[model samples]
Target: MALGLALPAAAQNVDGVVRPAWAPSGLPDRVVLSPGADAARQMAVAWRTDARQADAVAEIVEAIDGPAFESRARTVDGLSTDGVVRGGHGRYHTVRFTDLKPGAGYLYRVKGADGWSEWLSFRTAADEAAPFRILYFGDTQNSILSKGARTIRAGLMRTSPDVVVHAGDLTGRSHDWEWGEWTAAGGYGYAMVPQIPAAGNHEYSDDDDGRRRLGPLWAAQFALPENGAEGVVETSYYTDYQGVRFIVLDGTAGTSLDALDAQTRWLDRTLASSTARWNIVIQHQPIYTCARPNDTEALKAAWEPIYRARNVDMVLQGHDHCYSRITDGDGKASGEARRAQGAAQGPVYVVSVAGPKMYGLNDRALTQPDRVAADTQMYQTIDVEAGRLRYRAYTVSGVLYDAVDVVRAADGTKTLREPVESLPPLRLCDGDVGPDGAPCVGSAK
Candidate 1:
């Protein structure tokens, strides 16, 4: 009898076995690492898979040597949401891993119906007081793959940051393809570095019941810390890493006075009790915007006072596609007006964009900002050391567009490092079109 005759329909010879092509059961996309209470001890892993794999599981193992390492596995089943697009509905599943050891390097993999994903490795942040870096990107909401993706990849190549802070607008729309592009933009970097994302306007959509519902992809894809403010689960939260306290606020929720009051109280308490040497606030809307004609009044009214009172070191924001670094001193733009108005060591507000959307700098940008850039896609890398924090803003072309450093003294005063290489004056135009021919100004209403 022929060997083929003895083989089963799904089986073949040893060397010539007709095996099925490896069709990965679920695509392990949008993988992210999140920090727990203890940076050196715990981490959170999150990922999304197709609807077919409702029960998504993650396995983590400690890396003893090279690729092969000892490991432990944990399985988490996620909730599913039906997202209808065009005429069809798709399902998305999210799973998270918690209780990881701090500062330890671990390898993780996700399993779906078809199979398991390739092992990805990530190291938790070092114990408190360990110097580290973080990548900051603003508004990767439009043209994520075409224009924004390159900028994000460039930033990752420049520095291996411990975490990534996105200033909202992670996607232009809640559409799946947009989410796909958003995930692709980060590529493998997101899987490697834990991401701390704040909610943006685009992350909310009207549900079938006419009530506002979080975009199905937002929370489903990220396993954020549950330490957000009261009444809000994952929207507003604070995380401490290496003596730095990152207060992430939800501007949408804080837009109303009532909501703002609640968050304000929480923020005050969080800041007042924070023991971190460095305190930075991250939000979606800018309290002081460089692209918008006026600042976000609601946010400014509720948060700026706290920032000033708390001696917050920095304010990182997006929503405006321009670049700005608003400090206390009137360096290049400082005049008598600014000197009298500027805070003596108040919070340094920075608004930048890493996406393709371009907006012209506001009229005040040229005259107000210690540093400003218009019609340029950029990302920021900040390095925090024992007594100093250095920030470098680079354009997509890898040009050092702006640079600043803040040195904190034992007395709590911060010394500012001014921009050294200044670019040409930003040509003010009458229309909305920026110097790069993209619409700079958006609807004021």
Candidate 2:
């Protein structure tokens, strides 16, 4: 009376349950676009293929109205590396496209063992200072496929950003499957939009020798610019896009003895040399903690003064598992008072979380956060113009949660403007009950 009763028990319990749809195969998969140091004329893409496809082959052509554009396509060769993934051997390939026309759209595809992948399109940054939208996510560490996908899709679909920035902790443990999940969750969007990623603590793991090292897949998956501090080339880098100079720092490496000193010097040099209209620092650990009892004092001591001295516009960070935007470092005056007094604004610090994992807000959350959220997954969008930067945060359902405008004067002073309209009430857990009246899923720090 039972259906498929003849099937063997072992056959019924195959490992297909955990295998990702975007797993490495004869066909190219996990294609992601990343920017070079100068995005106006160069961009790079990375993908995975089966071992049979050892060589990295790609073709690019300026996008056109007709499908015959492939006639003008030119083949480009790239570097390839082989590694074991999910108990199987595969090859990762990275191809950097140079001398591309500024502000032009181009289509590209990679080759696999059997055939070529579908043509994915991307646009190069403008040669001059221009307005652009940036989608920023704090962390997509846990439940990347199940929970992180919705938030990522919301930001991508709603904002249609020119670029995406990850604060860090992209995966829970940097497992091969976790990386696969991250790529699968974003789907084709990862191929189209250029991503700026920072390295989180989770991106490092203990080797058999009991020494922690950066994850293996990091180098193989994303081809980032090597213009960073010495010894952290793969984990730290900087890129200038449109009118913003994004300086990505590795917080995990900062814990080391000499790495922080080297990075601090590099930070000063890079910031001093930046010609972009806006400067933003991206990293993992927050200078001001929202969920944790104590702030990241080491980062604050080493980088805070540099940020102030360099006049950084914003410091985007993650790892708190909550949301916070700190405009006033001292927390002595209200946002209105500080803005009305025309006090010189330092770099605005923001900490956020985009994953399912949650943590309770700590004592500092009471005084620091101008906007705060708990037990909620969110994404932020920043609209960058010559004189003003508009930032807005949205929930997974696309509801506006927070808004702020940083207006810059001709003299280079910044003023923080609060929300024009009423924002949704702060989302926080009541004792052990969540904002949704359900059992709280977050843990107390």
- Per TM-score, the best of the predicted structures is 2
Q: lDDT (0-100) at residue 262 of candidate 2? A: 80
Model 1, span 1-445: residue lDDT tens = 0000011122112252223321112565566667665556666666655557666577777766764453344555544444343211234444555565667877887765567777777787666676889889999987777777878888887767778899998887666566666776676777777788888777767668766556766766677777778876667888788788888888866763246777888899999999899999999889887777778898788888889889899989998877888884234445334435643456788998888776766667776777787777888988999988888888888877777778887878776755577655543444677655756544332
lDDT of 1 at 73: 47
lDDT of 2 by residue, 274-318 (tens): 999999999999999889888888888999999999999999999
In candidate 2, stretches whose alpha carbon ends up further than 4 angstroms from where it belongs are 1-23, 85-88, 256-258, 332-335
Model 1 bad stretches (over 4 Å): 1-25, 70-96, 206-212, 256-258, 329-344, 419-445
